[model samples]
Target: MERRSHIYGVMGEFATPEQLTHAVEKVREAGYRRLDAYAPFPVEGLSQALGLKRNLVPLITLLGGLAGGVGGFGFQYWVAAITYPMNIGGRPLNSWPAFIPVTFELTILGASLAAVFGMLALNKLPQPHHPVFNVHRFSHASADRFFLCIEARDPKFHLADTARLLQSLHAHHVSEVSDD
Candidate 1:
């Protein structure tokens, strides 16, 4: 049996957003996946460089709202007609008009709950740790500095070769992004 060596991601630091964006494109063209760019402010071409498709947040929100509406309608119908029925002034036992307000409120409530939970889950919130945090210079990510990190998890990742590739991309500085 043979053992494989672990390879981690490489981090390229940049002084300007332009350099970061350009380097990102070079990285993508170099045929690397599992890379992410970070900057204090959003850049125009950053998302395209990272090859991110549309976010699933909206889809989750929509599904949640649909479920909420259906649940609201079903619950009201069951309670009014099946659970307990009453006749007032010979009116129909299933009083649709009076139940409308409750149904509407419940729909809104359920949708709101779904939106909150869905957003959190989609964003993978409560993640207090990340390998990028190990880089002391990463704090600058929230400042004026911009960076692109190529994760070792990529299929083509090779430790020295990846670092060399970033260097060839004219990155200001390249360093290993480590989890340890």
Candidate 2:
């Protein structure tokens, strides 16, 4: 584990979602993309303010559903026509109509399962620890406060300048967040 850092970035605490939202917009306009905002509840237009446009979960789910549907249909066709041929009602060997229900059901199931797992994988969930937790009052982010964290990795980041910028946005308090 290599460690050499006194601070992670600057975190600005805000009392309202509006403040947080305005701060995020300003930060984005300031050409800082490495930032995260926290709020007690989902705020309107936050995602837009952050310019988060791409979402891959739905695409994953759709591909999963397609695979399931095709697999279900193929499996049934192979089973009834090749693996175990049984002519109960003299139906055609490649019985596509009979496979429809199972195909639909498996498609639904696969889509739902993919949505759950794909979202977790894409977002890199289950992160039990992070630098933001070092902030003493950050816990209130889930209670009644909003927070904006501008990471040091951003090209526009400068400790003092970022702090001053955040303050200029009317932050209630700006804290020097650490990674240790």
Candidate 3:
């Protein structure tokens, strides 16, 4: 019925981490949630500024590690007690003590793998392209510039108001990002 462009968001380029952080706080205070920041290096308290807490990766890792430990122990128990039922002189059929090492190792391995995968999934990695890439200045995001993007998907996002807000925040430049 109607054509709509795949506009991802409006981005603001900042000269310093403090400026970006202040802009982020202001945006957050202005009730914009679907936003992100990019910078040349890690900036302390950035996550706090963005109101990010309770990351799920650690929980994923814990559950995966527990599953691995249980699976490993159960496999060993099955092999010793159900499948083969090997018995040495006065030794128990299910030697749980010996199984602990393998179980622990598998637990660590599973946790590590889960951490990696969970982080990837959380960050939505393997994405070949993103709208932010359309900006010529965005390349400097990996160098000395700091960038903040307020996504169109955000319920609070209005093109004119968002651009105005970015300008009020003293952004060096404000540009729209297209999904294409």
- Two-way TM-score contest, 1 vs 3, winner: 3
Off by over 4 Å in 3: 1-4
TM-score of each: 0.81, 0.90, 0.90
Instruction: List, residue by residue over 44-154, the lDDT tens digit for candidate 1.
Output: 988887788898776776777777777777887787678876667788866777777777777677777777887788878878988888888889999888888988878
Give the Cα-based TM-score of candidate 3 against the true structure: 0.90
Per-residue accuracy of model 3 over 1-180 as CA lDDT, tens digit each: 111368888999999999999999999999999999999999988899999898999999998898889988998999988999866896888878899999999999889999999999999998888889999999999999999999998888888889999999999999988879
- CA lDDT of each prediction against the hidden true structure: 0.79, 0.90, 0.92
Sort by lDDT, best first: what order? 3, 2, 1
For candidate 1, the lDDT comes to 0.79
Model 2 gets an lDDT of: 0.90
Native RMSD of candidate 1 (Å): 3.1
